[model samples]
Target: MSGGGPSRRVRADAERSTARILEAAEDVLAADPNAPLERIADAAGVARATVHRRFSSRTALLDALAAQLNERYVRALAETRVTTAPPLVALQRLTETVFNLKLSHRFAVQLDAAVTPEVLAGLDLLFARLRDAGVITALDPVWCRRVYLALLHEAHDLPADSPVLTALSAGSEVEARINLLVDTVIGALGGTDTTNGLLVRSVRTSASDDRT
Candidate 1:
């Protein structure tokens, strides 16, 4: 029984260490995909041996990061309640979630293994629903999806101190930028009617959460 306590603590520490390494890998690789494991270990504030113990090689580490991003993507969708929420609310939540996801894990999104086709199809279906609801004026849902993704990619690339980010006085600079990105996407999709009110309410809830 005494041994179990120490074993559990060891496991917990290992888990924490692994998580740190993965986060550091995301940050480092996002900047330089060819960065060495030593660089990641330095970023994680862990020894090279520790990173090697968890990930046998750089490729393995990358694979793990991609998997972690996929998990986060799935979790983000669930948190948005995409299937049950009103179409406009769901679109705003989805856009924000995806924008933040790409912003946080840039390298993973670039990888081919990150998001599976099935997940993307569901997102496309969401766009189609918006079209059916008269929220998106685009005749082609595929075109709307492409435009939305393009805008997200552009928004994620904006520097933290950019004027676009600076103009919004909201919960945080990033939050403000994301909200603006959502609005831009909505506008580009021609959701310029009552959907604007729905989007505002959705963003207000998100901003409130950030304040708390």
Candidate 2:
């Protein structure tokens, strides 16, 4: 038992190192998918050997990170309690959670685009709820949903240090930022009176979609 403290410390440090590597991978890979492992190591403040010890190859690292991200996104949904909240509150909470998820881990956003049918079903419920509440516009649900996904993907193009993102990260009024985007979307959608018959649809994910 005398050696246990040192061992525990070593283990904790290793875990911290691994976490840093994964975070660095997300940030670096999000900007340039082809960024070298050396960049990630530098970002993590760890030796390249440490990263290699945790993930033998770049692909292996991404795959593991994807799994980690999926778990986190699921957790965020649960923590946000979106479904149980009131319509505006639920939308606000979901927007905050999703934008934060994307901001923190771009790779996770890429991985999540390969969404399962169950997730699409959840979106369907959310869209219907918002429709019932007359919050969303009267546009085609499928079209609206596609726009929503597009917005998420497109936002990644913003520089990591963009003033908009800086304010988003530091803002005391979280809803204000989300409201800007949401208001733009709602304005684009117009009124429910203009709604077409097009209902929500499934999200198809080709295996190669993540490569982009």
Candidate 3:
């Protein structure tokens, strides 16, 4: 069916206001999930009434954020080139990307409340695609999804003073740890061997340096 159209100016203003409102809402909620609508409206430089008009209620705003996060997830996954890498490597990269993104965005704290079952169920479809594409192991997609979520959740919670965080902030440590974790999980699933070659290499290298 053909849709009725608003004028270009009206649409543009709406688009701008919506973007501003979402950005402000994200900031406010990230700081405190229970922040009131008036505060969000203030942050957005809009009136409280306008905020309500734009988003009928707190639930509506949260729902919008959840939708925005899923959109980001889809975009990140699409941009990731997993076809050429081994399944484990691809999974590691994907998890690292997700973790890094979450660390930069405080909205991650609201994930538990904002992400509805329907949204998560939709994510299963993406997991299925990855599995079918052989970009991930043939384990239960649900389990894989949970693992991916756990990695992001843990990364978000990692203390700022942690050596892991320091290493990750410096370079590829986050990726390295994620790879190690994936390998461990995959090995436990009997999909591969747990040789711990990387750890062994690190230890051997450290001993050699000490002797030097």
TM-scores of the candidates in the order shown: 0.75, 0.64, 0.67
Model 2, runs deviating above 4 Å: 1-10, 112-121, 134-144, 154-177, 187-212
Candidate 1 structure quality by residue, lDDT tens digits, 85-151: 6666677777767877877887889977777775676677778887887877777777777887788
Candidate lDDT (C-alpha), each? 0.77, 0.62, 0.62
Error of 3 at 34 (Å): 0.9
* Full ranking by lDDT: 1, 2, 3
Decoy 1 TM-score against native: 0.75
Model 2 local distance difference test score: 0.62
Q: Which ten residues in a row have the lowest lDDT in candidate 2?
A: 195-204
Task: Give the true-structure RMSD of model 1.
Answer: 4.2
Best by lDDT: 1
lDDT at residue 97 of model 2 (Cα atoms):
78
The true-versus-predicted C-alpha distance at residue 164 of model 1, in Å, is: 6.0
User: Stretches of candidate 3 above 4 Å error?
Assistant: 1-6, 81-86, 112-138, 163-212
lDDT of 3 by residue, 121-198 (tens): 544655665577554565576776676566556655666566654533223555445544554545444444434435
- The alpha-carbon root-mean-square deviation between model 3 and the true structure, to one decimal in Å, is 8.2
